[model samples]
Target: MGLLLKEVEVLVVGGGNAGFSAAISAAESGAKRVMLIDACPEHWAGGNSYFTAGAFRTVYHGLDGLLPIVNNVDKAMVKKIDMKAYTADDFTQDIHRICSGRSDPELSQILVHESNAAVKWLAKHGVRFQLPFNRQAYEVDGRFKFWGGLSLKTQDGGKGLIEDLRRAANTLGIHVVFSTAAKRLGVDARIGSVRSVFVQTADGIEQEIRATAVILAAGGFEANSRMRAQYLGPNWDLAKVRGTPYNTGTCLEMAIRDASAKQAGNWSGCHSVAWDAHAPPHEGDRLISNEFTKSGYPLGLMVNTEGDRFVDEGVDLRNYTYAIFGKAILAQPGHTAFQVWDSQMIPWLRDEEYREGRVERIIASSLSGLAQKCAKHGLTNPGKFVETIAEYNEAAVAFQRENPSKKWDPGVRDGLSTQSKTKRLSLAKSNWAVPLIKGPFMAVKVTCGVTFTFGGLAVDPKTAGVISSTSNSVIPGLYCAGEMLGGLFYGNYPGGSGLTSGSVFGRRAGKAAAAASKTWNEDIQLLSRL
Candidate 1:
């Protein structure tokens, strides 16, 4: 086939939240021609964004501040809800704490400070927001108390988020072409600036599309087994994917290989979680989506094949710990673990992930019976499992007796722990420690589900322009956002922060690209006059 050519003021590669954000922002910022290309077909248009819970961790002024943008709460519901303000400092602390202070200071500050404005911009483009009642809040004392520092989500989660973004893009007249994969970044040798992109269509035809500016928001290499094994190390090739199969890091590779983009952030780290062991290994189920996540470990206990507890399950709230716990599970024997909860705590498990039919559950009336049932599913030592429960129960009961005032409140760090001055176990449940006395016990098998990779290109925090690895400077007309633009996260990630980071930088990249495109046009006109 002949090399087909096209021209646009701005070209965006990737169709997830970040790409859509950039396309919309570019169009709104006065770029007349903005085109977005996705490697997947129209059916797989949203990339990983479609599989998200659509939760966005942004700085908000509590209930009154978020009410103006959210659509789910009524006056009665609002009266029953208690939410605290999440300030820029709070957001910054969460990022730093979760990432172990390895997050880039400049990038994190930009993300934290611009988060509220980014969400507001998304809402202005018709994306609906709502309080995350089911995921981030718990009912206590006839009221819904929000916790985890995450209060907002899209109305229908990721599906709704993508739909709204697509609607806004179409309304803004941004051209979207599916089944087009970006293969290379075409740079002008004379100017050392991005001037074109070589792409491949579905029919095996290659084309070079010239553009004044290009924005890369094509996500990470989570879905690529080869790349995952290469960067994330041993057995990552076997980790189940939690999102799109299309995010194979094509555009990210193109930027690095062709534009000499500097790589940044944690190459070995990723956002993973305790997913249903039975879920698909290579790709995420669009219908089931985020339901595969098993985040209720904080409300219960997790045990490996040896029936021994490995990590402190209640060390922190689920938001802060869930992302890293998946790696812990993967490191265990058989790369699997059982999340055990009694009838008393089962009711609190979110229906989206733990409902009766959502995942296979093993139930038993006694702890011994539960252990025996788990043995059939790879629990190597039933006797040790029963013993572990007994020891944990004794520690928990003794701690409760020592500190009677400490209440077990899942909504806060209530100080209900399994460690006491006189009596302590090898490992302790730091908070919400309740003895496993109530039975009709239930357990679900879980394995690691890789969400997104943390390693990506380095960019200017202010402009979101990709930095050249050789020159240590911005690659003039090349910009990036979302998972492709890293340095914001390291060892772990705070829940709901990925989507927020995407929008925060996507907006910046888009606005800057549009302005740069306009300048390029002006320079061309001046040269023509000369």
Candidate 2:
């Protein structure tokens, strides 16, 4: 005979940020028995959240200059972003515009309304955060005034948050198991309700976990190349760069295999920022931080295979990233777009800590030395590359001179969608207005990369219950949140929204699941009596 199964009021799959918040919310929502499971040995370590700069854009009372600029959205929902700018209406409109009207309006409303509550809940659990005193240049309207996002300080920051949630869960008598992997989800055949979860323990023993409600918070499949190729087809190469090494999409696979789950949203091969992982300076090359979206000296200048500048140099890094990615797609398979900079930019890169440890002095010595460095990196012909730098410097000097008022604004306004007019003009010109006439330029190849695939299973707004698009019915007790749920974000991703979405939806899923568990229990009792 088969062994008897364990039982719980709620079962949460995956222990990343979404899973962590969901587990805690479920326990707090009055689930008598809750069990959270993760495949990681201890807890998830170094997931994408830890790598994030931890910026959150909100409309609150005190903050003024850190939120995104939302020009209009009378019909859209908006909320507190900061004190000075971005009212609730503005926030909702900005998000809705990004969504392009396809997102579930109910979920969007919940996200806007519950985001602050989620922040409060996180703070109550001991997550530390600071208000935005200064907004990044890209956040033109300052929505992030009153409340800012939290940054984790721990060996494994992602795991640290999970640990914090675990403690909160423990205090509420919730059960958490590490080194346990769910093998398959149990679903009732008649109504397609999730019946239980089957998992393999560390000792290689199979066990069944019965739950009245189940939440599948399993993350995106960025790490699974096979799935990426299958789902994305020609764009499979975009998934080569792994967002989280452990996110192999096993649960996503299981969901797709079952008849209950359906796909949502279209795949947008969003552009990604690049860092030379192998030859970075001492700190380890990541994205250039200090020089990002600020001044001109360390600004990014993208060039095509023929060493010609493309796109506006002064565009926001995130938006500029997409343009550069387009250039990469046009380049020969092995030849991608490259960023060329001078030795003078190294100090800014080093100070920001984003450049890792490489310094400007070390990057360039004399004209000849820079050329040799380029040759070593296989960027271009040493002599040709050096000459290109000198030419660019001359042009830069000339360009600056032609514009008498160098401090003049670029005149960007809302609804200006033309790409040609957005091209960056020179900030400083030479005596007679020439281009770059200096030497010792450095070049690094860049390719189009992706962080995570945003497409996945569809879910309802409030309950986060998994739904079948064909049948237009909810799989009674199944739920999903975080990167696992698609259609929440489409076409573009606004800053600070990813983490907020996960927290907001995860909590809703947990609370709704806990309530469903009780309803299921009562239904069973009534049936028994009948």
RMSD of each: 1.7, 7.8
TM-score of model 2 (CA atoms): 0.75
- Lowest lDDT 10-mer window, candidate 1? 1-10
Please name the candidate that would achieve the greatest TM-score relative to the true structure: 1
lDDT for 229 (candidate 1) = 90
lDDT string for model 2 (1-530, tens) is 11223998999887766887787888888888888887656634324554444444444433322212221212221353323344556557756766566666776677777766676677576554443223233222533222112211222333344455556766776676776777888878888788888888778999889999888877777666676667655555442342455566788777766645888865543323343323222121123321221122224355544445444454332321231343233343343445655544433232342343432222455656755664555445556555655555555544445543543221122211112222233332212122322444445555444445678788888688888756888888889988888876665555566667777888989999999988888988999999
Clash tally, candidates in order:
0, 49
Please report the TM-score between candidate 1 and the true structure: 0.98
Query: What are the per-residue Cα lDDT tens digits for candidate 1 across 1-530?
Result: 11233999999999999999999999999999999998888888798999999999999888998999999999989889989999989999999888999999999999999999999999999999999999999999899999988999998999999999999998998889988889888898887899999999999889999999999999999999999899999999889999999989888888989989999989898999999999999999989999999999988899999988998999998889888998999999999999998888999999999988889989999999999999999999999998998888899999989998888899998888889987798888999889887989999999999999999999999999999999999998999999998898898988999999999999999999999999999999999999
**Where does model 2 exceed 4 Å of error?**
1-5, 43-47, 64-84, 96-106, 131-163, 233-242, 268-271, 279-298, 304-306, 310-313, 317-337, 343-347, 350-362, 365-371, 381-399, 406-449
- Sliding window of 10 residues with minimal summed lDDT for model 2: 410-419
The reply for model 1, stretches above 4 Å from the true place, is: 1-5
Instruction: Identify the candidate with maximal lDDT.
Output: 1
